[model samples]
Target: MSFEIRIARQFGERTIAAEFASKGGLTALFGPSGAGKTSVLNMVAGLLRPDTGLIAVRGTVLFDASARIDVPARQRRAGYVFQDGRLFPHMRVRDNLVYGWKLAAPVDRWMDLDEAIHFLGIGHLLDRWPRTLSGGEAQRVAIGRALLSAPRFLLMDEPLASLDRARREDIMEVIERLRDELKLPILYVSHDRDEVERLATTIVPIG
Candidate 1:
């Protein structure tokens, strides 16, 4: 997978202009807070619209102001994993994972139930509720949920920010395994240098 983004957006007193392309692998948007890293990710995910510019993945134009083309977020096929797991408190782990999978188009469905469960190492917790899981476990389930959707790419916004040091390391290892095993291009956003150095194959500095 490849990404080419050249977009600009304004937020009150501040304006963010980002232009870059990635050939594949894990690309980390690295910078301090308020550097617009999350903003860029949001635009890429189609949650935020750019005032002007183009966003294309592999040659499919997701957005293009000049051509008046803008694909909706749900159709973009980009899986987003926020810092918080955001799992449904009312649903079991298995139900949460299958929620998006059920809605995914047949053509987009590549992962099966067992595959996603084993991939994130959450098979044993499938029957448990979200509240019963620890921070790291919740994040893993979150990642599994995104993967089950069979997304074209993954967008992670400081997924480790909410975890403790040990939990951070735990999730980091899982992310690294995902990068190597799944071969899915990931656009990871973070300000931590160590995390970037360890997980990112390419670093795009923001701000």
Candidate 2:
């Protein structure tokens, strides 16, 4: 599926403007810290409203300021994986993965529990708690959780930033597998050039 975004937003002293469209595969928003990568992602996720622009996925209009159409975040069906795993501390790994799955409409559900667990290699951690997972493992579970929600597309914001070199590599491999195997469109926000080079199919430079 294709994803299109052309939006602009202002944050007091800074005005962030971005415009780009990407087809299937990983699209990386590459830029420095002050650049607006995360801001653009936020707008796409329906967390922020743009001053004026349009966002669409597979020709489905998500946001159109001219038409005053802004889809709510929950209804957007866009799965978001933050830098932090954001798993429920009290739940087991399986519970965390299925949390979104349970909320998703049956018609929107794409991946099943077994498929998600296999895709992210989290089968072994199913019974474990979030607190026991390493950075890489937690991120893997987070990805699986998002996938189970049957998102139209995935939004990842610096998912590997908090990891060490080894952990980063470990997670990178999982990301690569997701890109190659799942063929799910991904909008990845990151400032690291090396990571972008290795993971992105289309590079949308920001800033």
The candidate that wins on TM-score is: 1
* Model 2 bad stretches (over 4 Å): none
Clash list (residue pairs), candidate 2: none
Give me the runs in candidate 1 sitting further than 4 Å from their true place.
none
Candidate 2 local distance difference test against the native = 0.90
Clashing pairs in 1: none
Model 2 C-alpha lDDT per residue in residues 108-176, reported as the tens digit of each score: 899999988877778999999999998889999999999999898889999999999998998899888
lDDT tens per residue, model 1, 38-148? 999999999999999999987789999999999999999898898888999999999999988998988889898899887777889999999999988999999989988
* TM-score list, all predictions: 0.96, 0.95
